[model samples]
Target: MASEKSVRIKDIADRLGLSMMSVSVALRGMPGVSEKTRKAVKACAAKLGYRPDPALSALADYRRRVRPTMSFAQLAFVTDYPVKDDPFWGYTNEFLYGAQKRGQEYGYNVVPFWLREGGMTRKQASSVLFNRGIKGLLIAPLPVEDGHLDDLTWKYFAAVAIGPSMASPQLDHAVFDHHHATQTVLRQLHERGYRRIGFLILRRRSTRVHHMPLDAYLGHQYRHEEDRRIEPYLPEALTAEGFWRWFDDQKPDVIVTDAPQDIPRLLAQRGLKSPLDVGLVCVSGQANELEGVSAIIQDLKAIGAAAMDRLHTNLLRHAYGPPQHAHGSHIRGHWQEGMTLKK
Candidate 1:
């Protein structure tokens, strides 16, 4: 017998005494082929070690089908904060959780990149990312001083920011609506007959709280012509000693802030309890318990998930252009009727 070359569809058809088209149809598991014949074709193909050419299959199928490589692609979660000691606590971790969940679904792996040690120059960071095959980037909130990030671009990559707004208009992003969120929270407080509400913000002028809540408070006060007060403490002044000094002097009836754990404890030290002497609400309520705390509740996990969805759309659709200003989903937080708020 002639040296039998690896069997092709033609050989199977010749052995089965069927037309090549019928054998091809049976092998493809297409309709019109009898079930018995389909099984026989499959068995013969398997025994002959016959493999379909993927390129030919793709051409026949017309629709492109790219199988994900078993190896996971790296996705960079870049931020300016220190990796080990992020001041926002669960904020970055929750965002990573969302990213990782989506990444696993799409056969990719997430790798966090912290720009510590004086930060990496854009060129240096880009080179490192390129070398690592990081084609997707989810930029967490960067300080305003980080300068222009528009220079960071790649041919086969998609990038998104995960904060309220990016200074650079050249990057796509999804962020919390601090202004609207503050407005909603304050309006709810006002409706609940809390006229003398006060806002306590950390001293850092660059922090988002300084701009969102503080500004919204000022704006709401002007719009309603209601008497209002705001006390700004140094970021370091978030300590118990520093909070007490301001609390003693300002004496806000109801306070809106982010530090539920520390600030509420300090209030109790002075023989004050929420909803009785004063009401307390936090802008970002990631604290362990909300029994006595009302908060705006920034959903960091949703923000991360939205960022990944946007990145995936951009990559798959080949949407490359200057960053488009896209608004993210703003989940309006409900005013939890904690003991901290009186009905």
Candidate 2:
């Protein structure tokens, strides 16, 4: 029997007449080696009773992560938004930061690639990315629409979507769990001694995320008495008259909305005080500068990091183009205490 120190990968290379690098990659189960070569290397190692040193593997992983090696690869963070630095893209900024941070740990650089930049066509952009040795693409969330990948060369790169907003490419995706977020909001409000919880979202916006918030809130409401259930304030076009009408009619104790910041300003028109008149809980991103609104805090940075991890897996497995069966990753968020509701 060969001891771990006695037999080495160089010996395995000598036995098979293969390069030590090939043998090492094969033994580590990394890509770039053929299946036949990998099998032969494994068989030869077993025959020689070779064992790997655990200390070496740990040190390699530590160095690769903690002090990441040279950046040898790049991942394109694809987006189609016309204005890259607009305030509307704040969420995009956070997601990009997370992805870039995670990519650095794996010896990879995350670079943003605007789809409409320089008026370049999709094919031109694809060729540029491929020629630059970018084999992975992280599709950032854009407007909700089908056929997001039409006419683009899709067979070259392993791709992943940052959120549910990207409807095409049929690639793996990571998104905040909207349904879980709404459930958290409703449950937390009830626990805080508030009933008649109401939900409000734009009619058009609700459909974009598959009506998840609406469905989750409705599911919670139906479990109680009919009178305690408040119909969600979903309107095609929301106005002060319409919002106030719904509020006066439903008379909810707490109004949960996707627009916490906008709601306070709107409420001031009627001189309706929050928490004193109606509690507000936000399912969307909270404005830290704004106060008195409770919220479900989403770990968007983690979601972005997870997206990079998923894309890296596909790159490792050589899963390029659209997958036959796409997998969706849903990351849940936690509750944030605020002065919008009283205990």
Candidate 3:
């Protein structure tokens, strides 16, 4: 008997007395093969210890792509963003730019699709993707965290989400390590001799990232004297009244938040200035717009690149749909020193 290393698809087919094409289809979980035959082919291949040759697969993929009749393969980067006044839209682009650049290196195009564009329904949008022969989907983070989108025809494609923002039909995802970033921010702030630190992120931003920011603030606070622990201000709405009330009550010597630039304006309104009366450290994002605030700037482009690499692997292994054991990565960000911290 030949060693399993020498086993090929032909060997599996020969044992079952089936054609190579039928075996290929069955192994890929594609249609046109009977359910019983598909099962048998898989079992036989496993028993024979047959595996695909990576180099040959690469050549085949190249040939299939170069043919004039075949279009360059594409992956869809789907989102549900508004056409106008989209607050988070700019930040979302960092993910797209990274994924797009990485995808180009793989000879794959990453295309964006809007879920609510021109009255097209989610079901219809899915059809467009399938009809266009796209088999990979890169889901953008939802506007609101903890949302579910079950109407998608998930069975036809290999899917990955940008973050944990999606709540239902959980998919493999790549995201920044928020908890790690929080710890980093806290350590830096403490080293600056600040004792009382307060956290404030209006809206569901805290919940969106699974409350890592709020949790980190509390954890750090508890490590200090009980008098140093200040309650965080997390509200559904952003208002001056709420902000001043929280500031008066907490009187945090330094504040950690998602938006440091905007915080200064709010402080100035009450005749207070950052670094004069308070300090600010941003953990959420917008590194460029930090306005001289100490921040843990996320490498969002890396998250996009990681996601693309995962999708490429899925395409290679023929892994489609939601996975039984979904796995992914969390890219870490670096700190950017700004004027908001104490010298």
Candidate 4:
């Protein structure tokens, strides 16, 4: 007698003088197997000490769930943003495009679920998604203050978050390589004969990314000449008054910032012009918007695509709830030369 682990359904079928299909249906209690045959199959299975193998069941299930031809399931991009103020349409639109494209490759369509407009509580939204057969979630960036995602039922789905903004529940995340981005910016500025570089960042943005930029900036300055080191001005929010004060005090030859929209005007107000009186560089800049500012083109879409990839892998492993050991995937961005910084 073979061990139960070595027994196959076909082996039972051979002994019972029934077809493999009948044996399978009977042992599994499917409709095609009558009561007498089902009982006989069960008795024989017991006598043979037969047991189902989870690995075989999982393999069959995986084959059933994923096919090369077309999508069989959906992934949700869950956000708390109001439709009108959706970040996806603004700075993060590229991220959405990336996620969608990658998801399609794996036969999964990524759909947006706006949490605020629907007026559904997190639990309600979870229920709706569960009913709709959504098994994976790509949690987008939320307000920096709202670190935890305790509102959603974490156990029901496999999830990965976009960026450090999703702090709690601590799912695996994909983020811009802010630390590297900052380093690249500083190195570029140094190579271009600029010193006394100051960073002006809104406190919220700095906090949202766990101060990686700040740490990188400080670390870089530490190893450089003392004259080249300038203190960063981190106001609670960006303001013209605060900007001038920092400008007057630090006298940075070049300013590095995430928000560059107001820098041109701010420079103008102080009787300064970019690349002449001052060099302004945006650490995170979109190609189209920051027309004249030298910047690091953060690949937001690539980050989204990475997050989708992580979520897909988790779903394949049937991983749910908080990860046992959370991880982060960092994406490096490229530098775009603009008119604001000296070439």
Off by over 4 Å in 4: 1-68, 82-89
**Stretches of candidate 1 above 4 Å error?**
1-73, 82-90, 115-121, 143-156, 164-170, 226-251, 287-291, 320-334
Native-vs-model 3 lDDT? 0.82
Per-residue lDDT for 1-343 in model 3, tens only? Answer: 4577898888888999999989986876544577699889989988888787879878865764464222247888888876632765878888888998888766678988787878888788889888888888999998778978788888889888998798878888998898899999889888889888888887578888888777777778778899888888888986888888998988889888886767888989978886878888888675667656788888889999999988877875568888888886888888888878887
Pick out the ten consecutive residues of candidate 3 with the lowest summed lDDT. Answer: 63-72
Off by over 4 Å in 2: 1-17, 23-60, 145-147, 287-290
TM-score per model over all chains: 0.65, 0.84, 0.82, 0.79
The worst-scoring run of ten residues by lDDT in candidate 1 lies at 60-69
* Model 4 residue 23 distance off true place after TM-score fit, in angstroms: 17
Residue 263 error, candidate 2, Å: 1.7
Clash pairs detected, candidate 2: none
Please write out the lDDT profile of model 1 over residues 219-334, one tens digit for every residue.
87777643455454446457776677776776677887766667667777878887788887776554345555777666667777878877766654345444455535444444
**How many residue pairs clash in all the candidates, one count each?**
2, 0, 1, 0
Q: Candidate 2, residue 338: CA error in Å?
A: 0.8
For residue 7, model 1's alpha carbon misses the true position, in angstroms, by 37
Steric clash pairs (candidate 3): 292-339
TM-score for candidate 1: 0.65
Q: Rate the local accuracy (lDDT) of all candidates.
A: 0.67, 0.82, 0.82, 0.82
